[model samples]
Target: MRRLPLAILAIALLVAGCDDAGASPAAQGSTAPAASAGGACQLLDFGMVNAKLGLDLSVAAGASLDNTFTCVLQAKGVSYPDLVLAVSSTTIDADVFGDMIQPKNATAVQGLGVAGYQMPTPAAGKAGPGVEVGWLAGNKRIIELSLRFAPGTPDQRAADAVPKVVELAKLIDLSSL
Candidate 1:
């Protein structure tokens, strides 16, 4: 019985390996992909991220569809900043942010980019620890770097993550778009 399942599994693995997938997801060298429509984000090189964040990062995988392009960066398979970062274009203007209900510790930040802000987790009780930094590139686009820590994470650590994400946002070159 065990041999039967092993044979079936082996055949499935062999078939998957033979599938004609597209080119490897790794971005070649430092050249970035072209900006998508509506003009919100540009493909960023891993070295650029490492230089900005002071950590070695490499692309784990990527995809491009129409006006959107996304590349995931990781260090030894770990997510960048141990969380998530998104630098992409959107049709909506920055004024949409005016409707946001600021969390307990959201603070307006100046000059991380055209404009920026940091949002920290609430100070009390049990809530997921998260921090986000949002930056505006004029009115047509906004870039955000965010991190979510394990529940019950120390408030100070959540507070600290916000600044680091803001630093990462500053590295993006909006003019290149």
Candidate 2:
């Protein structure tokens, strides 16, 4: 039985090797099936500190059937004065996803603020920096990307991540999604 399994594994490896040799150069270079419009938005490395977040790309329902990509990042135990690198485009916008982030050291809650449908406060906990990119869909269905790291203080990380995120966002091609 052991010998039979070994033989099967060997055969499988040989078949996989043959398939690779038959694949075209384009097939190896491009992972996606077809070319997308927005181009390709590559995910770069961003060093953040104790950060957690989500990236989602989905097809919008109704009307034109647009595609949207949202990136959210949150971190704890961050110091003061942070920077964030984010992506930028007319269709891309960055903002506080939920309620204002009341760090460990908060003075007071002055006033209420507008809330988004996907992000409601109270249960939402403290708000984190978020970037959203969207565009009309053509050949692609969805494109999602994210980068997380423990850079340091929240303020500093946010500031640094902003520009980087914007640059990254511009690289994203909605047509591929």
What does candidate 1 score on TM?
A: 0.53
Instruction: Write down the lDDT of every candidate, Cα atoms only.
Output: 0.46, 0.25
Q: Which numbered prediction scores highest in lDDT against the true structure?
A: 1
How many collisions per candidate?
Answer: 1, 47
TM-score of each: 0.53, 0.24
Top-TM-score structure, candidate number: 1
Q: Give lDDT tens digits, candidate 1, residues 104-139.
A: 345777765555677774533323576766655563
